[model samples]
Target chain A: MQDLLYFVQQLINGLTIGSTYALIAIGYTMVYGIIGMINFAHGEIYMIGAYTALIAITGLTALGIVWLPLILVVALLCAMIVSSSMGWAVERVAYRPVRGKHRLIPLISAIGMSIFLQNYVHLAQGSRNIGFPALIEGGFRFGAEDSFQTSITYMQITIFATTLVCMTILSLFISRSRIGRACRAVSQDLGMANLLGIDTNRIISATFVIGAALAAVAGLLLGMYYGSIDPLFGFIAGLKAFTAAVLGGIGSIPGAMLGGLILGVAESMTSGYLSGEYKDVVSFGLLILILLFKPTGLLGKPEVEKI
Target chain B: MSTPVKKLVTAIATSIAVMGAGHATAEIKIGIAGPMTGPVAQYGDMQFSGARMAIERINADGGVMGEELVGVEYDDVCDPKQAVTIANTMVNDGVRFVVGHLCSSSTQPASDIYEDEGILMVTPASTSPEITERGYELVFRTIGLDSMQGPVAANYLISQDPESVAVIHDKQQYGEGIATAVRDTLEEGGVEVAMFEGITAGAKDFSSLVTKLRQADVDYVYYGGYHPELGLILRQARQAELDTIFMGPEGVGNKDINTIAGEAAEGLLVTLPPSFDEKEENQELVQAFEEKGEDPSGPFVLTSYTAVQLIADGIEAAESTDPFEVAEALREGTFQTPIGTVEYDSKGDMESFEFVVYEWHSDGSKTPVN
Candidate 1:
């Protein structure tokens, strides 16, 4: 019973973190889906999102707004706006100019942009890790008082709820909305869509904007959950989310979500049962195995060679 | 050229020559290097502020040996590579004395360069014993080693007579080294160490680690890392209802931990350098810091100030600006500073340094535990 409870606790822990990974992974997938290039600056966009949310929260609190829901809503909106604009600007300045060039060109440009944004934030906010106030606290505990107990905090619940709502809206947006249909057309074939009277550039920009907005949501959620923020926070997270995107199938939205959850669970389980030192090794090793065995991710479609 | 314009040029040339000669004799450049822009820059701020204050005060008191002390600052970002680069820059810039390179990893490598390049360095906060163990004649510190602090923490835990203790670290040089030291001492003291583990430094989630702690059923946990990770762990452990007592070294002693951990920060046991800022003798110095709106209570601040003071005193005692002679004088001479009486061994480590266990409160205040 104790072992089972412990396993359940690990699962809960994994799912909470995994869901956030999914949120960031969507950005990578959507960008790749439309443009066929990795937006390396996406992580910086997420970091900016976190910073914006933090600034909003701090400002609102200073203004004597003690209401939690209002604070979260405003912060989330502000983060989304800022991150979306950043994403749009990055695509315009870094990616669009070299759209038809060698893939490595945009990749290099993205790397440069990432460095620029990291330094920009570093200079603006002194390199100290500012502690984010733990606004939501307490949780439900399971099992007997003396035995091993499984615990879930209100913050974790908030993460799950927010991810679910975001995912639902994203799914609906992709499937039913007119702009969503236009996005699919552009992703299918940019030149063909352009010839068919769809505004390919606008669709591409919209994809970046939407992806960035979701990443912002993740940033705000993870920032609050972690209780701290720093300029370089996005680098490692970007790498992890990139891994998730590849593991899920680069251009598939559902694949990114699945890959993220699997990655998160793998990491937590490694930390729980084995050791935290081995968690990264295990997660990456899992990625290598998946790449070897499946080639395409679990939900990813095999690409057909162009004639 | 006209006769009057030629005379004007001659006058300007004479003043330039005079200024150049004055520069050679008027100041001794003390290189201040540390993480000016990185994650650990908070500690660097303390180091810079303290050293700068010492230089300002020393200059106001008619300068050192009738020559002004000029601090040439460099940023290492607390990275070993950056530290080495900064050390080389200091060498090329003709600096003979240095006051920093804060993290143990960065300090060790930078000190190696300083030792080889005939430069004297007194680190205010790097505590890894390996730093001084190299027997470098030029490398010194104003802080206690992890070897000293680990034993202090272990002895305290042993006194509490806990059933089991778990030791954890962030797997960096400083964190892992201190954790290993604590683990060794606890084992020697016949205490049961339920687990010794390492966590990724910047990773936010520690749920799995917290769950493992619960399963280990340890009554005490000693974390060897900076405040950010420990703060998160403290809050998570509290949320998980794990009521085990938590302890850490001075790295976890930052007041920002209060904001991160909130109420969970209360009751944290931290082994830190005795609060020199609170001492009655330091009241005036404390007032000086307050006037500038700077908090002098940070562990590194007074230690860094002492490092600068020792450098000045060493130069005076040796009666020479040569780094080698100053190094010799520092090893042999005893000087009074804000922290305490400073006397260095041949290895350039202080003969005696004190670490006190303090209980940290949620309001970002700490009271020494008797």
Candidate 2:
């Protein structure tokens, strides 16, 4: 009975972490969906978002801005703006030059951008982990001495809710907005979209900006949730989010969400059921298995390659 | 008359050259090896800082044996392979006294090179018992061995009267060795050993282990690992609502743990060296840290500062700039430090002091407890 409760708890923890992964994975999937290239620097964009939020909060606190909600709003906005701009700049400077050269070339360039951005942050931040203020204190406990209990803190709930809202907004934009249609058209066939009078460049840049903005939101929440931020934080998170994107079926919006949640839950469950040390190993191992068995992911549709 | 003039000139030139050689002999060089980058950089930084502080303080007070001390900082990256490279570099640089090689795996290999090079190495924080027990004469440590620390933790748990204890390790030398030591000691004390297991390091999930612990109805869990894994464990455990008290060695005494675990880290107990900052005798040093706008409670700030002093004291006692002479004096000498009176045994390990338990406060400070 106790073992069952422990397993259930582990499952919940996995889901919580999976939800965060899902949030970041969505950005990766959406950008990949539209551009047919993995935004390797997307993780650093998330890092910058975290740093931006950190600076904003520190600045506000320094100015004696005691209102918590207002500080969060300002920080979130700042993170999104900075990350979006970074995405736009990366597209212009790195990706644009290598556009249409070869898929591998752009991918390599993205990797280079990733390293550059990581080192840039490292040098700027002195390679130290900076602490963020806790948005919530204490936890809600549900059980007595003999009872199995789980506590839901505000930050965990906020992370879950924020991801949901961001995904909803993204879905609405992709399905309803004019730019969204253009993004989808480009994803399906960039040449066709261009031939049909769509501004391919503008659509591509917008997709990056939007994806980066969402990533920034995830970064901010992560920093707040973990109460620490580091330059290298993006690397692992980025890798995990990428895994989540792939797991959910890369290029499928809902697939990314499902993948993220699954990855998080899987990780949490692994940590709880096994030793915390094998959590990453278990998740990544699962990813490899899924890829071998289902190349397109659980939710992703198999793409028909053009002859 | 010509022969006399030539002899006088040659004598004068030879004397000047001899004096220059004498001047060179007036300085001693020691190697400070540890991770100056990567996740464990803080340890290396502290070692460097402590060595620097001691060097400055010693120099300001007219240096050791009336000669100045110079330190060469090397990055080991906490890897044994890198440690070997660093050890080779230090030996090539003629640095006979070394202060570090932070992790056990790194220190174990580096010590071999140091021993082979006839260099005297004193680790400020490496606590694996095998470190000194290997019977290497040139190697030493200022901190208590895992033998001492493991028993301390085990005793603490026994005192708490927990019905059962779960022991887990990161499977690394340091983690596994200490975990085994603790397990053996606890079992000898008639404590029930609920589970003994090994886990991979740098893993992100701990749910299965938590479930196992919950199922076993273990009253306490003692993890033999560093902060990263510990942080995730605390967070995930809390998420799974396993509310058992988690304990570990000094490896958990990192500010990063608090950040990574967030609120879940609160009330976590860890065993570490006694509070060096809270020592009334360290008031002046504490004041110095405050002057620099640095927190004295940081993991190795005090230890690092003290390492420098130890070198200075060794140099002073030797009354010579020769590495062999200074090392000899170090082995024979004792010095008061912010941490406490530090005296190395024949093998270079600290002669005294026991590990003390501390509880991690929410504000990222550790308070020493009985």
Candidate 3:
């Protein structure tokens, strides 16, 4: 019974972290869907978002905004603005210049941009982990007097709710809005969308913008949850998010979400029941296993073979 | 023009010969080796600052053994392979004494090369006992070893009388070595180690570990890692409301922990060597560092400072510039330094190194607990 409670508790912990991974993976999936190239610098954009929130929170606190909720909101807004600008700048500078080149060329440029951005942040911010002020603190505890107690913090709730609302709004916007339709059209048939008077360039930029905004949200939530961040944070996080995208089916939105949750739960359960040393092994192993059997992620549709 | 050029060349050659002769009799080079650049560079920088200050004072006071002491710096970058390359380069470059290779992993490997090549090494920060236990005569340290520190930390935790404890390490040499020591001592002291585990050093998410720690109902979390991981664990555990007293080794003794953990860093306990800044007699030294905008409170600054002091004192006592002779002087003699009277046993480990537990305050300063 104690072990069962621990497992259930780990499931919640997994879901919380998975939700953050899903948020970043969405950006990877969306950018990949439209451009057919991986935006490797997307993780750096998330890192920038974290720094943005850190600076904003620090500045706001100096301005006497001690209220936790207000500081969080302001920091979140600042991160979105800064991160969206970074996303737009990266696409315009790195991707747009290499559009007509080979597919691998743009991917290489993305990786270069990722490295450049990481060092840029490292120089601007000192190489120490900046402690973020805790926005959401205590949590609800569960279990009876005889059983072992488990907890889910309010910060975890905030992370889950924010990711859910953003994903929902984003899914709805993609399905119902004209811009979303144009984005879908470009993903499906770029030339057809262009012929239909859709500005493909603008739509592509919009995809990056939307993806970056969501990633900014993820960065802010992660900073608040972890209470510390570093510039080099992008590499490992980006790798994991990329794995989450691949596991959910590259370029699939719901698949990214499913993959992230599965990855998170696998890690939490492994650390909880087995040894914590195998957390990464468990998550990555699950990814390889899923790709082996499903070929497309759990929710990802099989790609149609071209003639 | 040819006749004048010949004269100029001859004059330059004459001065060079004179300077070479002066150099032969006037100076000795000690390499301050560590990661001068990389993620752990701040630690290297602290070591650099301490050693540099010691050299300035030593050189200012006429020379050690009547010859000026010169410090040559080498960047090992905390990689054992890089450390090996640096070690070989130092020996090749005529550096007979070294004061670094700060990380235990780097120190342990480089000690072998230093021993093989007959170069003397005195590490200021590396504390894994295995570095000395390897029984290299040329290798020595001014800081307390994990063997002493782990049991010191364990005794402190046992004094708290927690029902159970969780022992975690970052799986790195220094972290795990110290943590295992604590675990061994705790078990020997009749305390329960509810859980013992390892976590990846730089893993950003620790909610999973937090959950397990909570489920285990451990009242004390004794971690063996640096500030970054400890900071995250404190914040995450606080978020989970699984409030347990979090303690770590000297690696967690840094201002970084406060910044990384925010207000949750308050009251964090760590076992560290007695801070030099807290020494009443070292007030002037601490003030000198503060006046220069360098913090003197870092874990290794005093010890690193003391390493150079040991070198200078050894030269004076041995009355010889020979590396082997100076190493013998260090192992045999006691010398007064900033960290107090230092003496090394036959194994070149500190003879009676003392450690104390400190509590980190929210003001970003830590005070040794009474």
Candidate 4:
């Protein structure tokens, strides 16, 4: 019974964080799906989202706004809006100018842009970890009080439900929305989509905006969860999400989701049952194993390249 | 990599050297290097200010060796490679004394350059034993070594008589060193170390660790790392209702930790260089800068100030501005600084150092556990 509770609790813990990773991974996978290039700056957008919440909550509370719910709503919206705009600007400045260049050129540009945005935030907001109040607190306990307690917090529930809702809405929109079909067309063949009057520029810009918006939600959620953030949070989170994208087959939405959950569970299990020191080693090991065996990820479609 | 850019940097260096040479005869120059531009620049910024305050006070007291003390500053960004490059540049620019290169990674590498170049390096804040144990005659640290504090931490945990203790680290050099120190000491003391774990710094979640702690029913957790990771652990442990006692090294004692951990910050026991900031004798010096609208209550301020004081006093004791002479004086003499009378042994480590456990309170303050 004790072992079962521990297993269940760890499973809960994994899914809670996995949901946030999925939210961020979707941004990476969807962007890569439409554009053959990785949106390396996606992580910065997530970072900016957290910064937005930090600034918003602090500023609002200082202005005599006493209500927590109102403050949270305003902060969340501010993060989403600010991150989406920043994403749009990055695509316009970093990616658009070298759109038709060699694939490596744009990829290099993305890396550069990532560094620039990171330092820009570092310079602007100061490099020290900024800690904000948790959005919600406390948890519900499972199992007998005398036995080992398996706990789940309200914040965890909110995060899991929020990710589920976001994922559902996103999948429906992609399959049904007009802009979604255009995005699909552009991803299939950019030149052909442009010739068919699909406004490839608008579609790409929209992709960044959508991706950045989701990233903002993840960032805000993360900030609320950790109650601490620094400029470099995006660096690791971005790498992990990129790993998730690759493990999910790089450009597949469902693959990204599956990959995020698997990565999260693997990390949690490694740290829980095996060793915390080798958690990262195991995470990358999973990526390598997936790449070796499936090559296309759990839900990713195998790609064929022609010279 | 361009010729013009290279030329521009050379011109800048040459002009600064010429300017330095102009004032070289009248004033003694001390170069302070740290990460003034990186993520941990806050430490460097405080250390720089502390060094500045000490220099100002020394100059006001009619200078060391009858020569006005001068401070030269450099930014190494807390990176080891950059620190080496900066060390070389400082040597080339005629800097004979240094008070910085904040991070242990940066200091250990740069100490090589300082040693080889005959520059006396006094690190105010780097606590890794490698800084002192390297047997470099010129290398000295004002802060307590992990070797000293780690045993202190283990002894404190052993006294509590918990069911079992868990040892965790962030897997960095300092963290690993300190964790090993505590772990080894605990084992030596015949305490049950239920878990030996390492975590990645800057990771957002610690749920698995928390769950494991709960499952293990570990009564105490001795973490050897900075506050950020510990903050999350404390929070998640609270969320898991583990009620485990979270104790950490000095790296976990910070205002940011309280903010990060929220209410869970309370009851955290951390080992730190005894409460120097609260000492009545130090309050005047702390207040001197506080009056000037600068907060010098940071961990590195007094230590960095002591670094400057030691260098200045060494110059006075040696009766020369020579690096070798000053280093010899530092080894042989004890100087009274703001943190109290401090003396360096033959190895450039303090003859006796004290580490006290402090309990974190709800008001974002830490009081010594006593």
Candidate 5:
């Protein structure tokens, strides 16, 4: 019973973190889907989103806003707007100019954009981390009072619910919305979509916007959950989300989501049962195993050679 | 038409230029290296401000032995590779003395180059004993070792007579080393260590770790890491309603922890260098820092200032700009600084350095507990 409770506790912890990873992974998978190029700066966009949310929250507090829901709503909207603009601008400046060149060129450009954004934030905010106030606290605990217990915080619930809502909306948009249908056409074949009057460029831009907005929602959630924010906070999270994107099959939205949850659970289980020190090693090891066994990822389709 | 006259003019010009160049050579370069822009750059700000003030004051006091001390600052970002690069930069830039390379992991490698290249270094913040245990002659520090600090923390916990304790670290050189020291001491003191674990630095979540702590049922937790991770751990642990008392080393003593942990920061036990600014003799010095709108209370600031002062005094005592002479002079001489009277042993560590335990409040105030 104790072991089961512990396992459940780890699962809850993993899912909370994994849900945020899924949100960030969508950005990577979407960009890869439309342009067939990895947007390395996607992580920076997420970080910018978090910073914007924090700034908005601080601003709201200074303006004597005491309502919790209103504060969170305004902050989320601000983060999404700022991050969407940043994503669009990054695509215009970094990815668009170098597109259709050597595949590595845009990849390198994305990397350059990532570095530029990191340094830009570092200078603006100073290198030190600032604390994110925990607006929502407390949680539900299970099990006997004297024995080991499983617990979940309100913050974790917020993260999980927000990700679910975002993913659901994203799924519906992709399946039923006009712009979403155009996005699918563009991702399927950019040249063919252009020939078919799909406006591939606008579709690509919209994909970036959608991905950035989701990442911003994650930024706000994770920032509050973590209780701190720094300029370099996005770098490691970005790498992990990229790994999730690869694990889920690049360009597959559902794949990214599943991959993120699997990776997070694996990490938490390793930390809980084996050792906390081996959690990262386990996660990365899982990535390598998936790449070796199923090179296209668990859900990714095999690439077809162009005639 | 006038070859002899032109030759005379050239000689006169050359002699004046030589005289000017000779006069410019009277300045001694003191290299100040640390994390100018990185996660731990807050500590670097303290290091820089302390060393800068020392240099400014020494210069204002008619310079050291009629030679002006000039500080050359470098940013290592608290990274070992970057510290090595900064060390080489110092070597090539003609820097004979250095005051930092803040993190123990960064300091250890940078000190090797300083030893090999015949440069004198005195770190004010690094506390890992391995740095001084290597029998390096030119390496010195104005801070206590983790060996001293760990025992101080352990003895305090033992006094409280906790039923069980959990020791945690960030798995870095400084963090793990101190955790090991604390664990060993607690064991010797007949305390049951419920768990000893390592966590990844820069990781945001600690819910699993907090759950483990609860499962262990420890009454106290001694975390050996910086403020950021510990802050999150504290906040999360509080949210989980784990009633364990927490303690940490000087690495987690930053005021920013208050912001990160919120009310959870209250009652945190931190072992830091003695509050030198509170001493009677340091009032004027503290006032000087206040005049410049700098806080003199940080553990590293006064120690870094003392590092520079020791370097200047060492040069005067040796009466030579050679690092070897200054190092020998430092080893042999005893000088009074803001922290205390300093005397180096054979390993270049202080003969006696005190680590004081303080109870930290959420309002960014700390009161000495032991």
Candidate 6:
């Protein structure tokens, strides 16, 4: 009985972390969906969002603003605005000039932008890990001591709910809104979209902005959940989110969500059952296997290229 | 035209003469190498600051043999190849002494260049036992060896009478060496070794490993690696609801671990040197760090400060700026430091100071187990 409860707890923990991965993965998948280009700087934007929230909350708390919910909302908004600006700027300066060129060229440029943003953040924040205040305290107990307690925390629930709401709103906007259709048109055929009187540049820029805002939400949630933020925090999270996107289907919105959640849950189960050290090996190993077996991913649609 | 040529020649001669004079009275140069950029740049920065402080303080006190000690800083990036290149550059620049090469892999390779160049190198915090055991006369470290720290950590775990113990390492030379030592020592002491494994470093997820441990019914885990992997392990373990105690060597004593682990770090035990803040004699050093707006609780900060002091003491004792003489003096000399009395063996390793256990608190301070 105790063993069963432990398994359930581990599952919940995995799902919570998976939700964060899902959020970041959505950004990667969305950008890739439209441009057929990876936004390597997406992770750095996520890191910046966390730092932005940190600085904003620190400033607010110093002024005696102590309400937790109010601080979170304001911090999230600040993160979104800062990250969106960064995303748009990155597209204009780094991506736009070389768009429609060789595919590898833009990929290399993204890599360069990734390194540049990492160093830029390091210089701005100093090469140290800054601790963020916990958004919520105390664990949620599901049962009595003799029986078993679920051990879910308020922060975990909040992270899961926020990710679900963001993902739902994103899905709605893409499917029901005019801008969404424009984005889809661009992704389908950029030249055709231009022929149909769609502003390709505007749609691309908006895609970047929206994707970056979602990444910021992930960053903020990660900062609150882990209670720490550093300049290089994005590198690993970005890689994992990219992996999640590919695992779920690189250009599929729902696929990225499924991939992120699966990756997170798999990691949690591995850590719970195995040694914590092998969890990463298991995750990447799973990625390699999936790519080999199911190239289109679990939920991704197959794309046929014109020769 | 002849007169103009004469004027130009005279100006050139005068400039050459002044340059020669400056070279004759130039400062004594020492090289400091570490990861100036990378995840561990914090350690390098602290080292540079501490070395600079020592240089300033020593210069204010008339310097060694009336020559100002100047430091030449290089970024090794904690890579062996980069370390070798930096060592070659330092040697070419005529630096007689070196204070760095933080990681063991970097230090081991760089020490060869220092040896060939007859330049003495003193490491403040590189604790791998093999660093000095390679029979390099010019290489030395002021910290205890992993051979000592590993057993100390294992003894601490043994005292707890854990039901079962699992040991894991990051597969690096230093990480694996320390982990093996701890595992061997525990096994020799009759403790049940439930699992012994090695994992790749820089891995982001550790769920599978944690799950295996849970299945193995292990009550304690001893990890021998740096903070990155250890932090992830602690966090993931907590997330998995595993309540086992985790312990590691001094390599896991970094404040960055607390940052990465956050609340998950609470109750985790790490074997490190005694706390400098708790040492009554280190009160002044603590004040100095505070004045500089840096926390003294960081393991490397005090170690860096002590490294600077060691270099200055060597210069003073040798009464010369020559690397050979100063290194000889350092090997034989004893000095009081913030961590207490310090002395080096002929292998250029610290002969005194035993490792103690400390528990990392959620507030980022380590509490001594005593």
TM-score for all models, in order of appearance: 0.95, 0.83, 0.90, 0.93, 0.96, 0.85
State the lDDT of candidate 5 residue by residue for B110-156, as single tens digits.
99999999999999999999999999989999999999999999999
lDDT of 6 at B85: 92
lDDT of 1 at A72: 94
- True lDDT of residue B189, candidate 6: 84
Please write out the lDDT profile of model 5 over residues A1-307, one tens digit for every residue: 9988988999998998898999999999999988899988989999999999999999999999989999999999999999999999999999889889999999999999999999999999988888998899888989998898888889889988999999999999999999999998888888999998888888889989999999899899998998899988888899999999999998999999999999888888888887899989988999999999998998999989889
Q: In angstroms, how far off is B268's CA in candidate 2?
A: 3.9
* Model 2 lDDT per residue over A108-157, tens place: 99999999999898778766566677665555655556755545666667
Deviation in Å, model 2, residue B267 alpha carbon: 4.3
Cα deviation of A300, candidate 5, in Å: 1.2
What residue pairs are clashing in model 4?
none
- Residue A120, candidate 2: how far off, in angstroms? 2.6
True contacts kept of each: 0.80, 0.29, 0.75, 0.71, 0.81, 0.29
Q: Give the alpha carbon lDDT tens digit for every residue of B5-108 in model 6.
A: 99999999999999997688658776888988766676777677766666766778887677777878999977789999989999789988888878887898
What ranking of all candidate models by lDDT puts the best one first? 5, 1, 3, 4, 6, 2
DockQ (Cα-based) for each candidate: 0.72, 0.20, 0.54, 0.54, 0.73, 0.21
Give per-residue CA lDDT, model 3, range A1-307, as digits (tens).
7777788888988999899999999999998888789999999999999999889998998998788879888999999999999999999999999996899999999999999999898788866677787767778877886557767788889999999999999999999999999999999878888999999999999999998998999999998888778888877888889889989998899989988988888888899889999998988888889878988887777778766
**lDDT of candidate 6 at residue B210, scale 0 to 100:** 64
Better of 1 and 2 by TM-score: 1
* Leading candidate by TM-score: 5
User: What are the Cα lDDT values of the candidates?
Assistant: 0.92, 0.81, 0.88, 0.86, 0.93, 0.83
Evaluated on chain B only, candidate 6 has a TM-score of 0.90
Model 3 agreement with the true structure over B1-370: per-residue lDDT tens digits:
6999999999999999999987677788989998776557778888999998888878888879778888999988778899999899988998888999799989998889889988889999999988988768899898988999999999998888878899999999999999999999899888999999999977889988987887788888899978888888987777776668888998887777777777778888888888777899899989988888998888889888899889888988899878799999998898888898888889998878889898988677887786
Candidates sorted on TM-score, descending = 5, 1, 4, 3, 6, 2
Candidate ranking (DockQ, best to worst)? 5, 1, 4, 3, 6, 2
